[model samples]
Target: MIDALPPLREVIETHGLSAKKSLGQNFILDLNLTSRIARIPGDLSGADVLEVGPGPGGLTRGLLAEGARRVVAIEKDPRCLPALAEIAAHYPGRLEVHEGDALEFDPRLLNGPVHIVANLPYNVGTELLVRWLTPKVWPPFWSGLTLMFQREVADRITAQPGGKAYGRLAVLAQWKAEARVALTLPPEAFTPPPKVHSAVVHLTPRPEPQFPADPKMMNRVVAMAFGQRRKMLRASMKAMTPGIEDVLVEAGIKPTERAEQVPIEGFAALSRALTARGL
Candidate 1:
């Protein structure tokens, strides 16, 4: 048995908690699954682990048991607080529970040298990922992001060039981090099971992105290009300028290629070209 906390089921039942579908909650009641996710980072000995949507403290307990120096858990659901409080009590000063929305929380202000490990709520997973990926600074506050997402979302995040699944997400995530699917879990792993299977994704921020380009510019170019993904760049980028072909030439990209076929570096070059053109 993993030490440092009570079993999650006892905590949940004691707190009168049931997973809420409205909040996109699919509680991981299985201690084994939670332990696996908590251990995905390889070693957590002295790391400050940031956990989001720690429903019933299943993952939270695992983090402590796995030897995290401290855990700062941000949870929006008030109903789950009692359960988390029990874990906090069991662990003493090692656990810090924040009662608020994670999207609005700034990790920089909390503590230094953080590592994010969470089984993110399905509804806000992608959006939260984009926010973390687009920070104004290079080498974000957290050491790395080890998160769980629906398997489909995981594929899109780690997808390579020249595929239907490859798009803005692949470009953005690949540009700044090395993301890989660490493990996959079936839908039956959870209490109130989600329809889609889940996967744990480990994303370590690179010291520098493969190509350095303005993030705002990259977002704009990718949005425009992938917005009409089926069309060639000459047709898709028509709104940017009538000389869209010239822009592609300057960026060292083939105007005939569709957005999905281009690598992340190609997109970075396009963003740079667009910036130079003042577009």
Candidate 2:
């Protein structure tokens, strides 16, 4: 909390940095708020933190102030580098800034258990989240994710079956991880307010999936079901494996059920049943 470095506004002005709509950037200049966000990932006493799209490094400063052992920040906009560099100089070896696209940047390059927390760019937020959700390994490489998404997307992630927001995203998120809406940020919190409010979601990977099913089969079942969401399972799954109705019965899912009405466990069960039949 005792960062003697220049104020973020001065840093932004000095670097000629302006939030860009094209890059989906919305800078948060408030140090107090940023610090609060940094603490959301729990006690960072000696944790390795991964941050994305750190425009002007407001959250980066917060992270260091809150005691992150090491922070690897990925920034695509070169304009923000000078501001981030200033913070790096102040914090010494605690901060590392990488100039590249976050989507292409790999977290495995850094050592230790990573706690990814960021005010992610709006445009690529959902896609990035999906990539993190479906990592090659179970229990994921990162210990957890504390991410900011448009509130609507957050709703979709934490949404349950039978809710309008429930779909493939909800199924995938809830099945493999324990996710919840941790906080909500009004549009005014950003430099250039977006049309909708933002939400912070915390997802802790489950040691084991809520139910057992092959990843590929589970994803395929989820995609097909939600893709044809409006249709019942018997009708929608017609294009999928044959004998779908029998599997639904075996999985204890109603053949007449629609995608939105199916629970995560049911989908996993149905996927296991389907794959077991060699379908």
Candidate 3:
């Protein structure tokens, strides 16, 4: 046992915390796996970690046991609150449990240099990642992110150009941070195994984007290019501006290239070219 607290299974049973499919809950009862995830972001001794959807507090306990300076857990399910409260009691002031939607909670309330680590709820994982990556500021509030997602989603985040998985997600994530799939977890790792496999992704924010481009324009350009990915850039991005071919030429991207054929740098170039034209 990592602490005097009862085993996770016992705690879940005691609290009547059954995994809720509606909420996208698949509790990780294994302390070892959770601890391993906690350690992925390197030493947490000096970082305040933000955890979302900590069903039954399994990852929350791991975060505390692994010596995170402080852990702020946001749980949407009210039934899991008691289990998390027990963990908070075990660790004293190290853990804070908030019962609310993670999407609604703001991370800016937390102090600087925070590291966000979580086995994010499946339903909200991608949306949350996008939100974190596209904040108004260049450098987001959290210094690093260690997040778990469905294998397919993980592939999209870390995928390179010219692949089916490489699209808006790949462009957005890779443009904003250094992303890679750090670990793969089998379906059986959770209490109720999901149909698909899961993988953990580690991302460290770049002080500034690898290439210069307006974030809003970049998103617009990427979305349009990938919206009709089967079409060449000349056809798909024609609506972006009247002089679409000129924009592609200015950015050094071939008009015949598909969205998947363009790398992050190429997309950023397109965005910059559009901005330069006062679009």
Candidate 4:
């Protein structure tokens, strides 16, 4: 984890950076740990990396030291600009820090096939993932995603059918990508430790989806089905459009089946069938 730079604690002190509860910031002051996280994406030497919320540039430094070709980092907090500038100067054009909210920024601005690696802000983690995953295009802007989230959310993202954790997130994540929990960290790892443990999730875009279906309808169908997860599909999806039972039958899913019991393929099939019916 040792590089030619000063330690993260010194950098934080020098920059006068402190964790902000409103922004969901928990600065990880350990460069050794940050370096380990940076390597999670594996050989970013040829990759254009995009990092969200690079507070004090701890992980940004790690990414550069770990051989990322270039990093386009988006950070909303203006206070960390000075510290990030120092890291950029040290790396000499290897890093570019943008002052903006990642929630509204355009990933298309970065180079093709970007790799998103981050210790995400807790408050907006799932919202960002939904935006990235539900893009209009078949293949997304990013080629790969290695992100940190609460352990509970990680379980939900990688969950499968017929499990307590399985639901809308599980469907959307696994439908078009391969996702898994790569690493787990204790609460004490952060500057001001969060209440729950954190986990690192690695996701790679699939060359093809689980099945062919209209993207908008696929998401809508899945949302409606899981909207009342405890109820049978025939009842839960009734309000989305008419002929709910027929749609399930066309998809080869039983009308009596609940949302949690249906696989991703089933949802895709349902969406395709619904689109065909022009409903």
Query: After TM-score superposition, what is the CA distance of residue 279 in candidate 1 from its true location, in Å?
Result: 2.3
**lDDT (0-100) at residue 25 of candidate 1?**
89
What TM-score number comes out for model 1?
0.96
User: Which of candidates 2 and 3 is the stronger one according to TM-score?
Assistant: 3
- Highest lDDT against the true fold, candidate: 3
Model 1 alpha-carbon miss at residue 131, Å: 0.4
Which number leads on TM-score?
Answer: 3
lDDT of each: 0.89, 0.90, 0.92, 0.90
lDDT of 1: 0.89
User: What residue runs in model 2 are displaced by over 4 Å at the alpha carbon?
Assistant: none
- Candidate 4 structure lDDT: 0.90
- What candidate 3 gets wrong by more than 4 Å, as runs, is none
Candidate 4 lowest-lDDT run of ten: 1-10
Model 2, residue 64: C-alpha shift (Å): 0.6
Give one clash count per candidate, in the order shown.
0, 0, 0, 0
lDDT for 144 in candidate 1 is 85
Candidate 1 — which residues are off by over 4 angstroms? none
Model 2 residue 171 CA deviation in Å? 1.1
Cα lDDT tens digits for candidate 3, 1-279? 777788899988999998999998888888988988988999989989999999888888888999999999998889988888888888899988888998899887687679999999899999999999999998889899999999999999999998999999999999999999999999999889999999999999999998999999999999999999999999999998888998898899999999999999999999999999999
